[model samples]
Target chain A: MTATTDTTRDRIDDALVRLTPAQVTIAVLTIAALGFVLLFAQEPMVHDSLHTFRHAAGITCH
Target chain B: MTLTDHLVRGLKAGAVAGGAYGLFVALIGNPLIRYAETFEHSHSGGGPVVPRAVTALISTAGGVFLGILFGVVVIGALYYFLEPAIPGTDGTKSYLLGAAGFVTVSGAPWLAIPPQPPGVEQALGVETRILWYLLMATVGAFACGLSGYVYTRLRPRYGQAPAGLGAGLVFLSIPVVATIAPANPVSGSLPAELAFVIQAVTGLGQVGLWFVLASAHAWLLRRDRDEERTGYGRVDHRDPTEPLGVDP
Candidate 1:
């Protein structure tokens, strides 16, 4: 019974170990992908409009 | 696995994911956006200039989906194949790491411009056009993706540094710095300068983003190694160590 329990524990431990790398990779990839979309997708118009609006509002620039 | 091994894996994953995502955006997303724009134009009797907010929201969503697909398909495939080459790496972990890294660096900049500027009838010079910007972004993403693919090919074969490192260096130090240089003949007005600044800042940010992406790849590689030792079974282990194989 003790031997069987040890084997089961080892299996679980091994599974956990194997899972760590994949989990990390998935985590990184997901984060990076989401980050790219969020950062790059929405800024151009806002920046351009803000500039235009500011210019319209009598803001001068060098 | 060692840092070198992890780094190599990460670069490979980044390249694949980036490339796939870029391609999808160019081929699939762009067309979809165009179609949507056309549909909008046809329906409204002189539509209230499809707001930048609406266009941006749609494009960003498209980009996100593309990024996710890239992570799942391209990076996942590369990880499976390359994991074995680098001593202790596992396929599953590599995929995960690549996915995480991709999502993190995917949406660092949040801005959009419509293909046609609102209320601007006469076409501004082609260079400053919306189409041009989209093309540039597409090309940039493609280049980044190609770099990822090349990184994968080079790493195990030559045992070299991650391409992201070199990309990060060049992107940050050169073009970005050049944009900041006073008296850029390219940009005339302050608004133009501000636009240029936004580009420069984003370019520099890309370098940091790439570095983070590379780090994530490395982390995945390390995790793969641990998985191997722990005897974790993968969902699809057969092609896990084979390069560029189709996912089952």
Candidate 2:
């Protein structure tokens, strides 16, 4: 690559590298949220049982 | 380090510090308060002021959670927006230095309230409580910023960064001690022995929380240093030969 093009590419690469941590953190948090949702969705029986227990105990679902 | 770098470092440090401190307060500090209360009652003739220890424990937990959340959000915003605006900035260290310094200095005010006597509730009046929260938040943010600034200045000379965490401890202790040493005696209100026990336990808890926070700050600083060196190589490079981009 030409010197100018090489420098531009290097700058872009540097920018990407600098931003990776934030991107990864976001990605991880997103995945965790999705996992939580999936768990809640799939475990209807458990959820129902817990809800019933809470209701029986006179605990309002706030 | 650039403005963005400083901001990132500060955010990381603040989050860790806040979380650590919050955990300490919730788990250890709250329990200590209960212990203090129990000791106070044992010494005094009257019954316990707070009927249930669970209530105080829950409150302490809620306060800690809120404090951590507030600390993270406020510190994150300050670093992300404000750090870059300052002129002649090179690295994140300056911002970190400023933040660390602020935390150390601001926490000093809480030291005036005696540990045993008035108790956390009575010693910290409504106005004082509000002020304390505001001050803690502000100081925490300032400390992160200051740490960033100081880091920037020192990084060039030393090559490898020191967390400057020792300074943070000294700063944190000033407020902790000051807050514990009451200026006036609690006379005619309650028995002195009861007050002393309550305050001592509560004060110990506060000290533990402060230490946890200081450790968190150190950890964050170390993490940032590692990120700077390996995660993002040579962040100090500013491309002096090229014109600065202005794509608004």
Candidate 3:
């Protein structure tokens, strides 16, 4: 295997081993919260707003 | 810190930043664009204007959603990529990084690829324009990064402030290069005044958004540190100068 691939694998392995329970919980909860916001916040009230806001803010997101 | 903690922390920061950005867009940005649209409409027939209440509600929602996105993305990248490369840092150091990032992501890029409102005739197709914008943004960010790396390398010999000024000059030159590069069709329909205002805000507003987002994120990080607890009903505190995972 190439040196770069080995290094990346090593980094990922190190990261996986290093995570604590508390840390894992934090990440999971944060993801859940973010998903919730993305799904619910874009309802009729904010859905249209995103387009206007995107234009005003200067660039198209997608 | 463990990867999970880092992820969570970054997510929190991103959410805060994104929310602030969304709010600014909803309140100030939305209104500004709507007004600018008038100029656009004068050149091209306008559609019916949406009600103010509807706009407000939508923008507010957009604000919250974006706040979460920014908090997660920017903060996550900081922890994952930059933090590993540098020493561990705390909320105290976040401001400098945040400001630098702001300049890289939005400020510098916008100089070359200024935002255009509707009715502005453009020669380039959408895909091409977007590709150009992405390229310009990358160049802007690269300039900022290279400037910092050079400043640190030069600091001991030149003294800190002078080295920083030199770096600042170098950092700013990238955009000038972009500006002077081959010209695009440019905005055709809008009057000079309105077009300029829209362009100005598109760039400046990002700076403001990043500022608020960083402040909120720093506050959250500070609070996280304060609430830190160990298994034994004791508070775990560390010297502020040290990075988060480092021992005293």
Candidate 4:
């Protein structure tokens, strides 16, 4: 019984630390969005719009 | 609850934090920027192409959007990956992650070249400065990650307090190491006091952004636990159909 309990606890701990497939999907999507925004920020229009913020954010900006 | 659920919760917290930061930028950041612009324009011998009010409005909106993005990426995505590895309770992890984000994004770079106000002249080109900034950010992240790794290793033997102290010493060495990088030479018509104020405000805004992000994330996670405890929303963590000790 003690052995079984230990195994159960170990299984539960492994599950807690492991990422689900759904999580991997969300992380990929989030990172993609971040990349898109950074790339888009280089556009003159978008850059100008966020100029003040870029400075406020301590980003390297004109 | 699944890690995905935690990710969603992080998103919600980020939205709240971002909105709060946006409001802060609109209120405190806009006026100082306008004042600084006058100095820049005076030097260039041309007026602002866009009206001050319009620029302020757009930038305020942008700030909010960026804050949300910060939340989604740092609080949501990164947090999801680092949750298991980070020390402390959920809230403490959130706070540490937020601190790490600030250190990586702003603190490290600022040490090399402090953020400039409008009209300041940089010795280096934008691209070069950006490259340097990215490098500094990488260094800062390495420092934080190494500190965390060291803490994990030491915690088993030394316990929490001593491990944290050791980790902190590792983190503290980053600034000293950062001095090895060349500094950005700056020249500007903007007054010393005004420039200092601008930098201060910018730094404060970032602090507020991360502070809110961490606090809200912690709160949201705490609420999730509270709900689970009260049986308002219980999640069965066990996969009953999967036999114990069997790999999925």
Candidate 5:
């Protein structure tokens, strides 16, 4: 009975660890996407497309 | 709820809010920008210009796109991760995150560099201004994290109201940090009234975005809880030690 309880406790401990690998992967992808839209994507046409947005959102764009 | 569930809900909320904001940009922001662009031509002559209609269309589309992005990434992912550590009910947590986001992204940076209308002359190069803006944003984000941490630490010792008020005071550091940061040297060629009004509109639009995003997210979470309650034998198998919003 004690051994079974210990196993259950161990399972509980494992579940308690927050942020699975899937969650981290999503966050990393999100940051990359944000960088592309906000910082990179600097071709003239792209800049022209995002111009009003950049200014309105207070990003430094010229 | 699982993080994925939260993310989907956040994306839905973001799409709706972003679509509305896009309309706002098209109706209000784009015309103001057009007026500002006329002033830019007076100084340096016209570069290639996208037509007004094209820009308005792009603004609406882009707003929806970004709203979804921010809703999932910032609101969904960040909120899910931080919910345990954040000292408040889920509703309060959502509102706090929204307010913090506004401060980090908009309010803090604007102190040093107000968003420029096209005619404003920036003394620094674009690279320098961008660098300064990034640095300000980082400081603002840091301040938010610090304040949240402070609240968690103080709440047990001092109780809720005092801890909440004390933690809020920590945000005063943002203005102090901005005062010390590099300043943008902007000389406006646009009419003073025009510049002021454009800045006002942009700032207000951001506030609307965050407000809608948070409220919708909280409402969705509440709806889920209500469903779970009404449905019989829906056991919550999550560990009590774990924070709220985790799915079994």
Candidate 6:
């Protein structure tokens, strides 16, 4: 058997092997969504989208 | 297994746990909310409020969503990331982790600022209240998580019961100290007894939710163990058909 050198394709393949595409997608999406929430969640502010959640979850916003 | 696989499983666990939580809220919490609202009205004198039906629907829906999200993000994603560093299996201590979560997210914050009945005025400003809530919760979570590590380290030296006792004290101390923070202004409107009922019901509900979440996640992990190994070994890793599974 002859020895072969690793190619660019092999390196890219190895690099992609670390994380699944789904992981990347989910991570990015979660980060973006959280960023949006953190950026805009203010009082008398954007919208009380989670008003029901706040009360329902036993969080005091009254 | 890949972190993604863990997250997928976690989401399934979250949904099931979240459903159980929603069921609990619907079964018990809905009625309490109605009674609390009525009490608030009787005490404070308010105009017409939303119908009981609407309140129940909203509450149940909201609870389910919240449970799922917490299961996914906190239990699933965060747990996965932290697992690499945590020694042994990820969920070796489910009950303990769940208890820690409860103390961190709700119990500690509740101490800092107890839930207010409707038609009440808050002593602290809105922003300040939110700031304190987040700060206390975050600090409490860290303290609780640290205690677990401390317990593990001490277990060999001191033995289980003693180590757990020490760690438990360390865990309790953070919230006890945090109790010094100014409390929300209470409106004398609602009866103390009724407020107590509300607190007790909601507190129990949160505990139930966390319990269900932990158990559900553990079950899912056990059920999906094989899939995780195979799924991790795969390349490209984008399986649209990949299931976020929960057992029957």
Could you tell me the lDDT of residue B109 within candidate 5? Answer: 78
The candidate with the higher lDDT, 3 or 4, is 4
lDDT of each: 0.39, 0.41, 0.61, 0.76, 0.74, 0.65
Give the per-residue Cα lDDT of candidate 1 at B114.
Answer: 20
lDDT string for model 3 (A1-62, tens) is: 11121232454565666667797689678966764444233344333445466556676332
DockQ of each candidate, alpha-carbon based: 0.03, 0.03, 0.22, 0.30, 0.28, 0.14
Candidate with top DockQ is: 4
* lDDT (C-alpha) at residue B201 in model 1: 38
Positional deviation of B186 in candidate 6, in angstroms? 0.7
DockQ of predicted candidate 5: 0.28
What's model 2's lDDT at B71? 35
DockQ of structure 6? 0.14
Model 4 agreement with the true structure over B1-248: per-residue lDDT tens digits: 55456568877987888788778768877777767877873532444456666767777877777667778778875675577677887779999999998998889878876888888988887777777788888889999899899999999998999998999988776788678777678887899999999999899998888899899988988898788668787666787897788534
Of candidate 6 chain B, the 10-residue stretch with the lowest lDDT total is B39-48
Which prediction has the highest lDDT against the true structure?
4
Considering DockQ, which of the candidate structures 2 and 4 is the better prediction for this target? 4
Estimate, for each residue in B172-206, the C-alpha lDDT of model 2 and write its tens digit: 53444345343433333455665555445444443
What are the per-residue Cα lDDT tens digits for candidate 6 across B1-248? 44566678778878988898878778776666556666554422343355455656755776787677778776776665554333336456455556767888788887787766454556787678777788788878888767777777888899989887877787677767677787666665667887777777778878888888888877777666654556654355455688755422
Model 3 lDDT per residue over B31-62, tens place? 77777666664522334345666766665576
**Predicted model with the maximum TM-score:** 5
**CA deviation > 4 Å runs, candidate 1:** A1-62, B1-53, B79-190, B232-248
How far off is residue B29 in model 5, in Å?
Answer: 0.9
Model 3 residue runs over 4 Å out of place are A1-49, A60-62, B41-60, B84-92, B226-248
Q: Please report, as a residue range, the 10-residue window in candidate 5 chain B with the lowest summed lDDT.
A: B41-50
Residue range with the least summed lDDT across 10 consecutive positions in model 1 chain B: B108-117
| Cα error of candidate 2 at position B12, Å | 6.0
TM-score of predicted structure 5: 0.83
The best-first sequence of candidates by lDDT reads 4, 5, 6, 3, 2, 1
